[model samples]
Target: MTKPIEVRNPRTGKFDYVIIPQSPKLLSQQCHRLRRGQIQWQELGIDGRIEALQQWKQALLSERDQLTEALINDTGRLSTSLLEIDSFFSTLDRWCHLAPQLLQDTAKNTSVPFIALQQTAVPYPLVGVISPWNFPLLLSTIDAIPALLAGCAVIVKPSELTPRFVAPLMTALNTIPHLREVLSFVEGAGQTGANLIECVDLICFTGSVETGRQVAVTAANNFIPAFLELGGKDPAIVLESADIDLATSAILWGSVVNTGQSCLSIERIYVAESIFADFYHQLVAKAHKLQLAYPALENGEIGPIISEKQAAIIRDHLQDAIAKGAVIHCGGKVEELSGGWWCRPTVITEVDHSMKVMTEETFGPIMPVMPFSTVEEAVDLANDSIYGLSAAVFAESAELALEVASQLDAGAISINDAGLTAIMHEGEKNAFKFSGLGGSRMGADGIKRFLRKKAYLIKTNASKDPWWFNEGESSKDI
Candidate 1:
């Protein structure tokens, strides 16, 4: 039996609604339904699929206001909540235009004598996507769109915390003709996600490294491929020649956006000793100016963490830092704003790798600023973490910045920009270490994840092939 998941308003500390968790049996049934519809879904062809996507795009745009409002209510922070909606719509639009070209079969050159060769991207029949609640819509449907465009049926298991937005989004998409059963959703906790991983042909999961490992193990048991886009403790390096204003703004937004609940959030900052004081002052001033308000407020910049459990973790990390000779530059208290799970945006200095705030993934509004004497030391500090999802280097000299970026052990390194810019490309966005596995869910690589490649060779003439020797009697020379 599954329990009801309370959808709490992090802003008001009130249980706004509850979602009845789907049992494993029901989740399995949804998978079966999706599998049954795969053939007909593929028959819809690229154009037909694009047409359906167009309908989805229009539906999402038509209901943008309501969706944004729901997100704000669910998570708080109106501006940050809109980021999810905006990303969803923009991703949908991009896939609709690119899927046809991306999914097309390609001709290949043959090395075996004179045979014509070709290859096709054959999509898996059913793709399972387990999305996190941090950016619910973006992670949930972003991977699913590529699978659907590649003619695969998708079953999305949304995070139990933020299941509210997905149901309405699915309802809107189902309004399109012949899409009700083709696209499906199951809402529940981890068990439901486990069921999904076992049933599908391929699994795409976005969440913590611990849970992602469990998903990977489950997929391994079932002998299916799994794509794990896990956690990150991303870092930012500011050189002596860096633009203080730009680097400060990027670090502030990069670290505190979505209340530091993002996978690409910059949890650590390494600044050169020459300009460390200037950057620290600017960062503290910006952190102090942030408004931590209720979700109901339209202009709120900082909002509450998702749950008391998460808030406690943030508190523990902060406490650990302060106890370990770290100085809190600005905002370090957990304020009960309207009884909400709110924490002040915190900036800490005199930090080292021993503290939890500097080492672990603090998915809250906490930024640790440490100083380095050389660019090499800065790079060393940035690459010292066990997680390497993304990193950034800020400097006026583009050449030196790029050189430093190239040496960092991260999936994507940004020069004088936010670490999250890695997702903007349509290429491989793989995690270097424990951050994730497989390629990114963007561009052709994203579409290809759900596809298995098959090679074809055809003979133009009836003449015997040159290398037609029997396997039992291998020829020494041709």
Candidate 2:
């Protein structure tokens, strides 16, 4: 007998529901059904698929309020949860408009002679998405929209911590007649995700670096592709000529928003040595001014970390930094907030690369600051990590920022701003180095990742090509 997956409120620490785990046998059966549905679903053609996706998006929009509420309860970040809803709608709109064109057949030129060829985009029959608890609804649903628009079935296995929001969203999606079996959700822990990966044609996972490696290996064993968006120790570089106030605010929010759980969150901050003191002072002051409150209050900018386990990790990193001579300029204690996993918005100075807070992903309300003497030094410091998902460069001019950004080892870099905008933009979400592999979240590339290309050749007349004849004709040139 499979154990029950308990759904708990991260903020309240109380049980919301108990979900009976789906056995591997049952999940495998579900995969077979979804694969069968995909055959007919793809045959419905692009127009039919687009109409169905549009209707599903409309259904999700109608339930925005209830979904937002559920997400807040699960994640405990109010403003970010609402912003996630807006972002979801935007993604849905973009995919609906762009997917059909992206997935259309392309006319290919024959390089050698008078041969007609066509390249067709064929989507995988089944895509398995293993979404993380952070930004659960958006991550789980956004990828499905494009896969469905490209005429593929999607099965989402969301993190157990996020079932509260995903369950309701799945119910709304099921209301669409054309998408009844085209999309499905299975709730469980790590083993279930492993089982799902084995059955799908492709896998897209978003989570920690350690888990991402395991997913990659599993996908490799099956000879299937896996898109992994792993953890990031993102750095923020504040140049000497930057607007100190803008730089400070951007870095502060980038580091603390979502209570600092974002993979793109600014973990290590490098300011030009000339402006280090001023930037550090302003950043700490602003961090102290942030309002920390419950979602019901609607006044909080910083909320609790997701769970006690995550809180423990944050605490360990903060302690490690403090022990290594890092100074806590402001806020560095686990909050005593009732029924919620809370951590204070913390800013630390005198940080070095030796500390875990500066080197590893500190996914909490903690910011570590360092100083660099030159642009090359800043680039070196930013790139000195095992992960390179995103980075930020703040300068007086876009030209200057771009010059430095061009040298950074990150997949996406923001100029004079934070990393949030980079991820929201249509063509920018990707990871470099150990951060990920083989896919993006937007643009033509996003839809194409779910598709395989097939080439067709046509002969205009009853003429046998020289290359197609016997080896005796190989000596003849065309």
- lDDT per model, in order? 0.83, 0.85
lDDT of 2: 0.85
Q: Could you give candidate 1's per-residue lDDT for residues 137-159 as a string of tens digits?
A: 78888899888989899988888
Error of 1 at 110 (Å): 1.7
Summing lDDT over every window of 10 consecutive residues in candidate 1, give the lowest-scoring window. 419-428
Q: What is the lDDT of residue 71 in candidate 2?
A: 89
**How good is model 1 by TM-score?**
0.95
Clashing pairs in 2: none
Q: How many clashes (backbone atoms < 3 Å, residues ≥3 apart in a chain or on different chains) does model 1 have?
A: 0
Model 2: lowest-lDDT 10 consecutive positions: 420-429
Off by over 4 Å in 2: 421-423, 468-478
